[model samples]
Target: AKLRGENGCPWDRKQTAQTLVKYIRNETEELIAAIENKDKENICEELGDVLYLICMITAINEEQGNFTFPQVVQGINEKLIRRHPHVFAGTRYKDEEELARQWEAIKAEEKREHRQAAEKREP
Candidate 1:
């Protein structure tokens, strides 16, 4: 983002999240195509592009004082650990279907918690 600072790249400096959304969406589509084509090299490149966009968005959010990158990382890490009790807490599922159902349930619970947190944060 230094490239988008006071004396940074004008192109990047002028870009907002709305402008970058298209690029991120395009990169996602390219990544999906690469996976469908089974091209390892293209997949790796596309994945890198997607990661770059994610970081860019995070930086933009941080600059706006909305949230930090660490918060993003922590949220995902916590969600993964919470969702996968089988892996993290030694809880077992009898089958793939059962595991999927449990995963969805956990996700719904997390969504509810997030909604409540947002409500609490609102003025």
Candidate 2:
């Protein structure tokens, strides 16, 4: 937050989520390369870079009243719990293929529900 405060870095303060997309892509590619090469040090550094970008984007959105970082974290946490019912909710899957199929089905249902909710919210 200091980096974007009233007396903060002008460059950082000027950044928006749209402007940070390229940096996010670059950091993600570097992270993938680090993982592919099994470079633990580079992987850690790239992961931090990616996380920093996420925080920055979240901060920008919060500043614009779109959403906050905690909301984003909470949403993902809820999604993880929702999607991993086998581990979290005592749901069982026979095998990896079955688990994958169930996961896809859940994802499709979520998408359909989201679309319905969006349609209701529109107009």
Best by TM-score: 2
Candidate 1 structure quality by residue, lDDT tens digits, 1-123? 796789998887888889998999899999999999999999999999999888888888889998999999998898889888999999999999999999999889888988999999999
Error of 1 at 29 (Å): 0.4
Which residue pairs in candidate 2 collide? Answer: none
The parts of candidate 1 lying over 4 Å away from their true place are none
Question: Model 1: what TM-score?
Answer: 0.90
Instruction: Give the TM-score (vs. native) of candidate 2.
Output: 0.95
Estimate the TM-score of every prediction.
Answer: 0.90, 0.95
The sequence of per-residue lDDT tens digits that candidate 2 reaches over residues 1-123 is 999999999999999888999999999999999999999999999999999999999998898999998899999999999999999999999999999999999999999999999999999
lDDT of all predictions: 0.91, 0.95
Q: Residue 79 CA error for candidate 2 (Å)?
A: 0.5
Question: Tell me, what's the RMSD of every candidate?
Answer: 1.4, 0.9
Candidate 2 wrongly placed segments (more than 4 Å): none
